[model samples]
Target: MSDTTNDTDAAGEGTATSDGDADRPTTSVEGAGEPAELDGLAVDEAVERVRAREPDRDPETVRAALGFVAEDGVVSRDALRESLKLTSKVLTTAETRVELAGIALDDAREAAESVPDLPTVEARLEDFAAEVAAVENRAAALGEDLQAVVDDRADPAARFAVADGLRQVDERAREVQRTADEIQFDLEAFERWLDSHAVRVRDLGEDLDALAASLDDLATAVDAIEAASTGDAVETAAGEAGGNAAADSDAGVDDPARAWFDATCSHRATGLTVADLRAELGDLRTWADREGADPVGEGGLDDLAARLDDLDGRHGALGERLDAAAEPEWTDRFGEAVAAVESDLADCAPPVDWGVVQSTVEEHRADIGSDA
Candidate 1:
């Protein structure tokens, strides 16, 4: 062996080794024997390309690739090729990991891009649940009011009470429903906004603000409704003490048909389900909700009118009492009055206030004052 068996040897000289050594990895860089200047620009450009292509690669792998053939910010062709091979392998591995991570790339991108807003989404979801609860409760109460009205139609006060309750329920239900729709809309808008951040980076603050405002409004409205209900506002409006026509009037319409009509002539005609209108109106609403699919399929408006006509003379208990009290007591008193009027005319002679004579004569309706 030469006294100088160094890395500075010529190309074929350093490569001339035992077969086992040849099989071992080469420790020398590109241009092993030649004195060539290292390319710094080329190294940085290649590293930048690898980084650009595989940003999520292992840092250690990236460092290893960058340091493979680099020495003092200088790189050789042979070292650059080996570094590129490592970087390509790392890039391929990163791609495989991303593909097999059991999540979508778009979802991953969205997660990374919107790192700070996740808590806001979670909070909004909680708000949505609460609002939905309120809305559903309002709808349920309205349904109950409608049902109570349908169940009993005896007292006008109670009927009007239910109507007022129905109106309140309808208003409250529709209000909450609007809020629910807005909440859903805002949430969907936020999702769409989040997804489009890549195309046009938009913050979710505006959407969040709008949703917050809507929730605030709903809270105010629900609070008002609750307060009105708990306090005397709604009760006074509902006429708890008075406004019951039935209470003021001694007669209960004396007829079921007239009573139902007088009570329900001004009621709203929509949004009622079968359970809400369970009484006289229940059948009508149920049929309407079924799209005119009446099971019996026989009775129409004419039949309903005929049924009302059947109750023309059908008086209730109160009507029977009134009729009995207002009946004539005695017919003998009328005859006595006529005999007295004839006796007065026979004895008193003419020009004796003919008006009175005529009045008595006409009331008696007998032959006592026929001459006058």
Candidate 2:
């Protein structure tokens, strides 16, 4: 029976009892504690306790309490009412109250369309406006705190220190600017000097190169002149050889030995016995004998006279040619030498007969060949 009474109290409904006991409340006010009497505590104190404990309680503990109450089939309408009033009081003082107030006003206006309760909605709107005013006061206090922080950053001593540093930097910048100007002036002067020196050096290099080229050209001209002189000497030797061959060819018709002897005598008479002329005449006589031609006689004498005249004419022509070929400065000396040789040949006279002269020449040639 005791268990049955406890179960009835847990169910939150009055149990049927004997007599007047049925009219009495069945719940045990003892287990409910002071919190169960929702009307006894002030709404502000209740809100404060709920807010503190709710933030600290785990979700499992809250869920377990709810489940236990649900299983017991217990419902406290007064506690529920008190909790709702506490929530409204707490939200009025919250930082987001203004935003919440706006949301609540919008919700109330939307609810008015579905329900005919203008007076209730108007009362709720007035409550929201009062809460918003409190939030505005809190926001104004926060704004003042932010301004104080800003003012501390913009203090007079701090501003003065910044200004002093800026002035010093400006003065130093001007000094640096002056130094830069001086450096630029010096650089410009150095560049000008460098430009002038560069031009002079380039001109000097060009002049040196021209001088070297001219010297190279002069050297090449000298080499060409020397080569030409050597060629002339070779041609002269060849001409002498040719002349000797021609004389030998004419030997059978002339007394070459007699003519040579007479020419030598005439050269001696002029106080000029050139060894080269003598050697040439000697070579002619030897070549004639080597060819095995006839000795000289009267007919040979006539041929000899004709050959001498032909030689004289050729010598004159050679002199004229030499004069034409000679440099202006060298022509006079060359002409004089040619004239002397012609004069000596013209003055020559022979005493030996052409036959005897021919025999003597043949003997001399034999002697020279034997000696060689």
Candidate 3:
């Protein structure tokens, strides 16, 4: 056998024992030794290349082949050859595992980055809500103060001052409303953009909740301001001024200014008067003349004109009663006259009875003269 033991010894040391030492074959395996050496070199090179490619790669998996060699008992050249081949296979698998783990880590990081910080967004929204509430509360308080001023039983000058203040507050409230509308528009636009971006519901909810709360506060503020600056308050103040002027007139103090003021105010309030009636009659006559219509006769016109004349005659009698009582019933008489004139004008047909109308006017004038 050409010294088979010597050839086996020359191949390398530490080969695994056969099933029985006495029956062991002592010979060098040619192809076996060559493949093991090549495998070991390939494994070493692969480990180095992987480490270079991924600087942050886990050292444990890469060092797994080396650790296997050091532990698990002594290995012969034949055994070492087997180890190297097995280690190379294991290193290849470890590299694949490391690559997969790296991919997984990258995907996890991207997912984390894409998510919004919901807590931070919620905190910001809460802060905005607080600010809006504060503004609304202040506006409401100002409106209440305005209402108190309007309700106060004050003099004309004082009432006028309060009214002016109320006007200013109303203007300010309108400005606030405008601002709130603008902010709401902006919020809607932002929400639409967020929707397009497919933002998370939890985050969008936080923002929308704040905005809705703000809108509610703004609405409350507007209601309060409107309540304070109501037309009723203005009218009440005007009524008080008129009553004072009337009181002054009834005191037998013939102040022309007071009389005019009382007359104007009472007429506005009650819609009455003799002068108002005369003016209405004049307007009706002008209208009839312009439209080429009769003040009486045919259709509903005759009935309406007769009714109006009767009403005017009744009003002239009432004026005599007011004069006898020495009460200023001008407001009441004016209202009756205006109604009569309006009714007559509304019922006037073509070919108005100008003669009857003229005669009726002279009779009313004579009655008014006698009453005066």
Candidate 4:
């Protein structure tokens, strides 16, 4: 009957649930006496049992604490069992919260359709970063408490205080997990906003690529003209011993040499323009400022299109110079390079790989050089 009553008390019978009347578990060590069952078991056997159950636990710490609790080396089997059970329960609860929080965090990350605009997403990420730092600080404090538990092995009261501190840590972890569950992000909406802007950015990149290709064509045309002049100069000098034949060749060679000097001037102009374009591509601010376009502001697509039109103007101006200085047959090669770039731009979709486009331009540029 006494055991039945004690069980009922533990189950909250005859206990008020109302505020100021609720029965809370106390960490007080003012109990009547140690249980007889604890006195019956040997110290070594009880410690060994705890070690078997908790392989990760520091056996020496448990042994030292139990040794201190034992009177004249006679340990309490029931006390050891109760301590192990409570410790296991506390540790399991804390770890379970951590695992659940991890699963919730991973789920949140996976569910994210996209990150919103830079400034907004950065603010959101900062909040989570702070939460992570808080968790790390709490874990460090818990570790210090664990060390205190080991250091206070000779004092049962100090050990009990440390145990209470661990319980508080567990409670805090549970709260953090609850917060994680409550917080949700509207990632799908963010994705739509991002994709809308991404398309315009992609178009700007394509336009820049077309401009880069035109510069490459001009450079290749200059190289072809220089090569032809050098070859003609070499041939004219070699055939000078053949009197009239060499004299006849001089006019044709002089035309090529004159064209080479003109193309050299064009080369310098093309290089400066190429360098300017590279600088714009290398810096977002510079690119945005090109033709006073604001890529991230209202009517960004219109601004980018205007910038593209400016690029086209530069291309037409440069192509005219290349064609006038280049051999008539080489005009076809410049058109081919432009055609290839247009084909690539048409095939590209949103989230364009500019590296691949550049590489394709390079390959086509190589073909142009080989033809020259």
The per-candidate count of clashes, in order, stands at 1, 0, 14, 3
Highest TM-score scorer = 4
For each candidate, what TM-score against the reference? 0.23, 0.15, 0.21, 0.26
Go through the candidates in order and give the C-alpha RMSD of each one to the true structure.
Answer: 39.3, 60.2, 40.6, 21.3
Over the stretch 1-372, how does candidate 2's per-residue lDDT look in tens digits? 011112223222232354645543332233333232222334334333333444665444333223221212222323322322332233223324344444544554454454323332243345445544554455445334323322222222122122223233233334433433443343334233223423323333343344335334433433343344344455566687775433222222132222232333232232211222223233333433554432575433234334434444444443343333343333332334334444534433322122333454344444434322
Task: Give residue 136's error in model 4 in angstroms.
Answer: 3.2
Tens digits of lDDT, candidate 3, 1-372: 011112333223343253433333232222332111212233445345435544575555544432332224322234333433343333333333333433433343344344343332333334434434554554555445444533331222122223234444444555555544444444444344323322322333343344345334433433333333333345456587774432222223233222322222222211122233333334434444554553354432334335445544544443343233222433354445434444444332322333444454444444444333
Which 10 consecutive positions of candidate 4 have the poorest summed lDDT? 1-10
Error of 1 at 102 (Å): 28
What ordering of candidates by TM-score runs from best to worst?
4, 1, 3, 2
Per-residue lDDT of candidate 4, residues 290-358 (tens digit): 535454565455555466556656656655655555554444436555556546545533233344555
Which residue pairs in candidate 4 have backbone atoms (N, alpha carbon, C) closer than 3 angstroms, thus clashing?
Answer: 38-76, 38-77, 38-78
Could you give candidate 1's per-residue lDDT for residues 1-372 as a string of tens digits?
A: 011112232112233265644543233224344222223435555355444544675545544444544656554434433333333343333333323321332344454354333433344344545555555555445455534533322222122222233344344545545655565565555456444422111232232233335334433433333332233343354476566533333232233222222111101111011112122223333333444433333344334334333332221322232222221221132334434544654432211233444554445444423422
Report the alpha-carbon TM-score of model 2 versus the true structure. Answer: 0.15
Backbone clashes counted, model 4: 3
Provide the overall lDDT of each model, using Cα atoms, as 2-decimal numbers.
Answer: 0.36, 0.35, 0.37, 0.45
